[model samples]
Target: MARLPEPLTPLIQRTSIRQVGRILSNTQLSPFSMEMRISWNAPQTLPVPGQFFTILPCRYPLTLLRRPFAYSAVTESWFAFIYDIVGPATRDMAKLKAEDDADWIGPLGRGFPLPSPDVKPILVAGGAGVGPVFFLSNVLAGRGSAHLVVIGAREAKRLIRLEWPSHAEVRLCAEDGGTGITGTVIDGIGQQDMADKVFYSCGPAPMMAAVHRLAAECGCPSWVSVEEMMACGVGACQGCAVAAAGNGGPQEYKRICDEGPVFASGDLIW
Candidate 1:
């Protein structure tokens, strides 16, 4: 594992907000993915890109634990997430209709750090990781930063549809060559000039590891959002521990929920 000179620190630390959010829409984005929009009252602080929230189906008594999801889009009184229907909880979530209420705790965990004004931003996302990267691209665009977004999936049907930010450039790739670029996200990334650019990625473990290696080769800083099976959305259960590289010191573990879902690529033993 590689290590950067400075350690990555938690950027946001506000107390978690628990609320019953009303479902505004539950739309299917692709064959395997669904987008759920929720609206709440009392206007709370919006979540930053890469921060996650845990949601539980109010009607499903069989589901014991809440599932963590990253924000795909956000507004003043509403937010949305893109989820894959992979388990009992997500299946139930897909069944939910408008006007239903779901229990959720939000704005938890750390988020991606803002890039310096002089550096270009390159965001890579695949599978379920597209949500946060999409949100981040909009944020960067709002700040007058032109960035590149690379999204990948196994096939065209698996790719998510979104009203992408107009200011940011996008590259789409699929393994089956059913979409934009006929290769993986790495192939799209390879076409860019990496100098003076910072990389942020989220996807399957193997894909992120590949991005980390590419970033290292380009001598660019990289941050990754890790996906793990989390029993507790908080650090109490210690269920989502990722091994730390420790640089030259003793190895340790960091909690993905508490310490980060976002971390410097060099900070973890990928």
Candidate 2:
């Protein structure tokens, strides 16, 4: 794990900023989709992937709400994220043009670990889960490990925005049968050999639960990031707790904020 920077440490709890830069999507989806990237005037690199940064509304909007999104990708020059603009916070992001800014705080929670070279990797995602998977995919590809990526959506149009690896084999699934593969992305995994692969997954609770089952069936290891309603992104407020197995096979609670947004397969309970 990388050490947290001192400057970013304080801002981890602050929200709202003077607004900074805006990023535009090169193309729109059937309805509309745009990639939004914002930069903080704060003096540092945004936190690592799997962690998130929040964008607080400035006085002009008066919505006064903050929207949190993951650290999708980063370079020395900039950090990026993908947005579908389905709601207010993202809708605000679509409105800003270049040169405006949004305050950023992160690299929060632990990121998914890559599979060791001796094992193949399988990446699965649904909806916005695509954002973080893209970040993970690029990193693994650079190191020369091949990843089989499966993305799922309700229908062809609802499929999430993604920037995929140049060398990876990509598969998409639409429940209504209109994209790369028909049915669930889970179907994509069934068609392949899981004998020597490890899995990484994210998305809806039911979806993650299902992937957890599949990984166990194949005798493969798996990890996942949980998405829960949150107030404070850190441990202080205690908003995001996951169910874990307690001492008598009874239920226990684990904080997603302090402990993880990411967890090993055995760490979670249905």
Best by TM-score: 1
Which residue pairs clash in candidate 2? 19-101, 20-100, 20-101, 20-102, 21-100, 21-101, 47-106, 47-107, 48-107
Provide TM-scores for the models: 0.93, 0.83
lDDT of 2 at 166: 76
The residue pairs that clash in candidate 1, if any, are none
Q: Evaluate model 1: give its TM-score.
A: 0.93
**What TM-score would candidate 2 get against the native?**
0.83
Q: Score each candidate by Cα lDDT.
A: 0.85, 0.67
Model 2 global lDDT (CA atoms, 0 to 1):
0.67
- Can you tell me which runs of candidate 2 are displaced by over 4 Å? 1-33, 40-46, 59-65
